[model samples]
Target: MRNKSRKIYSMLFLLLFLWGVLWEAESVYAANWGSVELTAEEAVLMDADTGAVLFEKNAEEKGYPASITKVLTALVVLEHTSPDEQVSFSHDAVYNVDRGSSNAQIEAGDVLTVNDCLHALLLKSANEAANALAEHVAGSREAFAEMMNEKAKELGCTGSHFQNPSGLFSEEQYTTAKDMGLIAIAAFHNEEFMKIEKDLRYTLSGLQRLPEGNILYMEHKMMLPESRFYDSRVVAGKTGYTRDSGNTLLTLAKEGDRRLVTVVLKDKSPYHYSDTSAMLNLGFQETEKQSLEDAEGFLEKIRAELVEKGTLTEETKLHFSSKVMLTLPKGETQEGISYLLLEEEAEKKEISAAEAKASDSGMPDAKDSALPHIVFLLDGRKVGEANLYREQNIRVMLSEASPKTKAAFFAVTISGFTIMIAIAVFLFGGGALYGAKNFADERKRRKKWKDRRKKRLEEMKISEEEFRILLEKRKKEKKN
Candidate 1:
């Protein structure tokens, strides 16, 4: 009873120990997504390539965009008007903007090309430039705002509405940080728009204030080389400010192999630049490109666990059908990646008897044995997935041993076979010897019995003939 109880305790202790190891390993791979202090009420950092959100604070909460609305305005105008096409400013386009707001002070009937207007809209944050572009593209500001809302919906912005193209304060003009990030991400993909936005300095010659060309510098501090907030990694940016909207800044920057888009809305002046810079630094520090070495190491560990659990044979292999170049958060190791082995789907086809026989005798498909997948998770939530399979290139190295390993394996196999053969031979030889000896002993016993019978007949003083007659008479007497 004591032995049985002790055995149960041993098994329970072993299970507990294994569970503790797995729990610790999992804990070591998860990230803490630390909070950052910022002046903006809403902010977000996103991967430009994947549009994956890396960080956010109230990103979905709607707030006034101010002049950052011009990003969408530029997008809408670029759709309809070529950069070289002439856009005429109407009386309303120049006069409808609030008196103190930023503008090029254009007069009615002033004509500027769409490219000049884009430069003014994004670089100078000119309200008149936005109105001129909107009216030229859609015939009215209201119509243009409607187009902006429609485009926002198509871009998957859930909490966004546009009341004006200039981003001027209106009860209905509101957009979330996330929505603006998405818009910037999509816009940056346009080569023409990128070309226009990336310029740090441009002179507007066709404007009514400067037919001789007025030098316009970008308000985005990060793009200026002399500004304290300038980041060499910054590729392009847009800045916004209004009495009601505070400060809003959107920036796209690249460092090493990463391209990031950061948005800060409703931050204090100058703090917008600092907040954006902080966000960009955080994005660069917290995100990393998955390395091939890390992937290989992770697969090895998974392979070992699968082998230990008997779900996978020692010779079974694993591989990715496509390259796994995901940008994941810092502290997220391959250990955070989870896998699932999908059930093998059998192929159905008519087979000839010969083909069936061949298939039954040949090696089975590797996928028939195992189907693996890599699940990408962030903050314990699944974000993406990749299928893992055993391609011909991923053949099990264990199955194909090295020269020395193969030599050792063959030697061991031969030694085992020899031992088995020797044991079989010994058993056969011993059995044969025992059978022969038993036969010889049986022959001797039969001869001795005959001799004893003869001796008995002699002792009874009976001759051969008389012995035979006596034996017959004894048989008859016994029968009677």
Candidate 2:
């Protein structure tokens, strides 16, 4: 009984050790930002290209967006109407928002272009502008809200829901930092949307009928240089404030060639630009680390391939041998040499001829002998083939190209052409030779046309009197 008890305790201790190791591993790789100095309830930093999370503080926690909700509102409006289309403000637009909501000073019956309204909505964070844009798009705010929810689903924002054009704080109206990051990414891609978010100041045209008839002007709340940490990297951002979502900010910044999106919600202070700045700094640092790791991984893959090919000894020691200077995208995978064996003997010439046939047949022979045949398979289907040494080179080439190239060369060449032409010519001819032949043929045809045109111009160069006398002499000779 005592021995059994000892075994149980030993097993328990082993499990605890494994658990500790797993915990440490997760802490190293996990996105969770623990105990940050910022007072935000939820925040996130994500890569604009792959939407991979670089850092997070309660990123999944639900919160409000306030005027940032207008990002989606603008998306819906842009989808329904062109920028130059005019939309008149109705009483519904003026009063549909919460009683104390921020206004663009848009009075009922006011006329403004959709583009101007979007500028007010995005740059000014004007609740009235959101309402006017929504009503114009779908004939009412209720229908526009439906469209917003649908778009959110399409964008894979599962943690968000919309109940109003302007975020007026309802239990039903809530979004997480992760969801908001996605919305910001989608909004940033639109040219006009980026323009509004980045603008520091905007001036509205004077109302035609108002007695005061003064131009309305507003400045970005988060653009104050002295407010907190200033980053020229932050090209565009949206600031939102309410009793529920205190001092929220969504910012877009570019560093070198990469773009980053950050979101912070429900901060303790009314102005949380400092928190935003801190988050942006953290994001840039994390992104740099990830980029470095990616470059190292690519170099290591090349080194491994070299080792496999016997070019470098596996145990060879060299400082900085695994250093790479290129940036590879996230989730990038390197190609590795794969081998196959044929069940029956086949000639090398037959194997070469079988390239097209093997692809169509979907079964390839893999042989392990002198001049061994190698077939390329993607997702278990044979794509192409080569001899042993050539195959190894192809594998290395594919690995290097995969980081920078997508859709394969054949797909790209065939995409722009008509289906019949692409299939008959590009697919049959394969790579460079087919392209060269077509180019040369076109040049020859053009040259022929040029020569014909030159000859016609030379014939027409005769004087009008000389041409008439020659024509009369030819006619008299024919009569005789």
Candidate 3:
């Protein structure tokens, strides 16, 4: 009997040690968003549409963009010139580049269409082509660089200054990770730019062809299937390197209906690629995106309250100003999502219709902001929010617009709403989230999921006492 007691005590001690160790580990794992490690000096991960930052480290600090500036070059060229327009390479364009830099070997007076030059500029990072295209668009490289800077400012970039189109080292030429990410989002959203950059290989048919049959291949290896850093999710990207700049990378990836942009700047080779991959993983794995359209209960509550308060009219059709998305921890669920209407009586009337949810949940936890907007919450934290708009704005914009405006509006609308959102989800925090990817048949009765967890716990030699509560929550949820 004494030996049996000792063995039982030893087992309990082991379980306690395991539990303590796991708890500590989980805290650290989520300490810095799964401790997203990166060697890049500056990096950013963001939603392409809303520009919500998912991850960052010195993202606003200025760093040399190197050849990644070509993405902006491509954007400017697309905006100002047509693909069929012919561009004759001037003597200055052909020879006025940093010697030993990338070039397509085009001779002065060689004429190529803007489309071919773009392929060369993006795929080959050809310095001469960059200058040639710039000269064609704005009459001189200096003029084109000015155009580039103006466009960058217009795109909401605060820490960017452009002096050259080829991204050749210039003392004043620098951009922040945040600025580059915004530029990437704009460039990739354009259909013409998307088509040109997505091509894996292009043989320039320009009159002054390179060494005859030489082909240009995309420098970004992540999009190349055979590269070790290849990620199938990467739809478009750019790569840059220079002694001063180290390395720079910009990547845009799509998973399901979500679009993510990642920028890593001023890092060593391979790590630049690796850092981008890590940021992409961080965004896709660490966060769950919830769309406002699914929150019918919250929407109705706001509508009724607004009507009652005379803030809205009975004929005032309300919808999210845009298709707003809220990103939260992967372990969160739809019901955990709460809101506070920013109003004079907001403190008195917390709309916690779900039980004492109103009074219990500390609403208006956000910093001072504009009034008359709904502030969204999750687990007592402000995740994101949106303002209500009269529905007629969309109709008026669509109806009174010209044919071109209407077509563009429809395209933008479709592009924005292409993805679906879901109810809030909050799972027990672990290094990973265990939310079901499919909800069919209520996760197929959840039996297999439970069995899998049971087997994992058994393998660890854990008893019902340790993780039973965690597993039992699911059982109780299913019963409800």
Candidate 4:
């Protein structure tokens, strides 16, 4: 009987422990599970300022980014060149549909400013624009790719490696949702980048003519009116889709003082737009709740501490009076009750006397003269009252420049001009003008040689009969 009782007690204890463990597990699952449904392979919502992860779901999983890789491409271009700088397309930028997957319609010889190219790349997901901008910035796509990797390291994007400026498919070129979010946050800070990504409709001026002679227009995919996730607060974002990576989105949203960075990658569901929208909404709501809870706790602590100390006294009251009981005329001054002590009368009298004397003397109050007095003190002495008016016009002369200073300034200016001239000659004269001249000379030489051959033919004046006889004689000599 004793052994059976001991066995029953042990079983009851074991059951209770298992139940407790199960309960805790369920509680944890409940805390994490929200109303929003997420289909992304990897997703993250992060604080832009602190880089704090508010929520994450498989955020470290690697996935294809598709055209979203152009975000890094845009970042590299913006770092290297200004927006207004012109970029001319090359043969490399020509989209050849036969050569794998090429999306952009940009062709060789088309010209666009770097700013405009960036717009097409980010908003329209133009692969040709991405390549053109990359080549323009770093002289080659490979070098630009190296720069992108270097920048990734600098930005602490450990999970990303860029093989191309255009996010073409390669197993080696992959990034986690968290790393993409970080990159998006960094890119969003630049005004030019933000402008291009958020712009719904951008008319690219110089897309190459099609076979049909019609010009092509690049349109923003994310800015489509039919997109359910569209919000004015979304300053910038990139959207990407591929067979491997279903759909990916990186968005920056600002509402009031709150800024959110959201990244969703490899979503398997058909309603990607709605899924992202719900996730972002839930993230914002959760963050707000957390912030309010923190604020309330802090305020409660402060209130408690203040009440415990003498800082907040019960008699320190707010009196309320009805408007009807108060016979106050609009714009009329009323003298309220003044609290004073008899012991402080002398000090008050002195202050009032000084103020009255200033008023009677038609002089500005002491407070008005505070800045001037401070300036005078800074200058090591007070200027006379009359000189106060002149102080506005008085410019403090800097001491005479030393001989070394004069020499340095002259040297710097001369060197600046020298560098400027060298750059102008190398860029304009050596590259364009010299090439043009060389081409012209070659053409002239070719033309002259052709003229000489024609003159020789005319001088020879060989008739058709003579030419036929010479050809027969040559054929007979070869047979012998």
Top of the candidates by TM-score: 3
Candidate 1 error regions (>4 Å): 1-29, 291-324, 334-377, 380-480
Q: Rank the candidates by TM-score, best first.
A: 3, 1, 2, 4
lDDT per residue as tens, model 1, 1-480: 999999999999999999999999987755656457999999998877655677889998879998888898888888888888998998899899887999765678889899989998988898989998988988999999999998887666889999899999998999999999989887778787889877878887765666787777788888888989889989887888888888998898889878889899989987888888888888788777674336676677766765686656667676666666555767566555544432322111112222454433433433243444455556653333455554332345335434554556668889999999988886688867887888999999999999998998899888889988888999999999
Candidate 2, superposed: residue stretches over 4 Å from native: 1-35, 206-220, 224-229, 289-480
Root-mean-square deviation of Cα positions for candidate 3 versus the true structure, in angstroms = 22.9
Best by lDDT: 3
Per-residue lDDT tens digits for candidate 2, residues 334-412, read 2432223321223444444455344434232222122323333322322223332223344443443433243354465
TM-score for each model = 0.61, 0.56, 0.62, 0.53
Choose 2 or 3, whichever is better by TM-score: 3
Q: How does model 1 score by TM-score?
A: 0.61
What Cα-based lDDT does every candidate model obtain?
0.78, 0.66, 0.79, 0.63
How much is the lDDT of residue 136 in candidate 1?
Answer: 90
Order the numbered candidates by lDDT, best leading: 3, 1, 2, 4
Q: What does the lDDT come to for candidate 4?
A: 0.63
- Model 1 whole-model lDDT (C-alpha atoms): 0.78
| lDDT-superior candidate, 2 or 4 | 2
Worst 10 residues of 3 by lDDT: 362-371
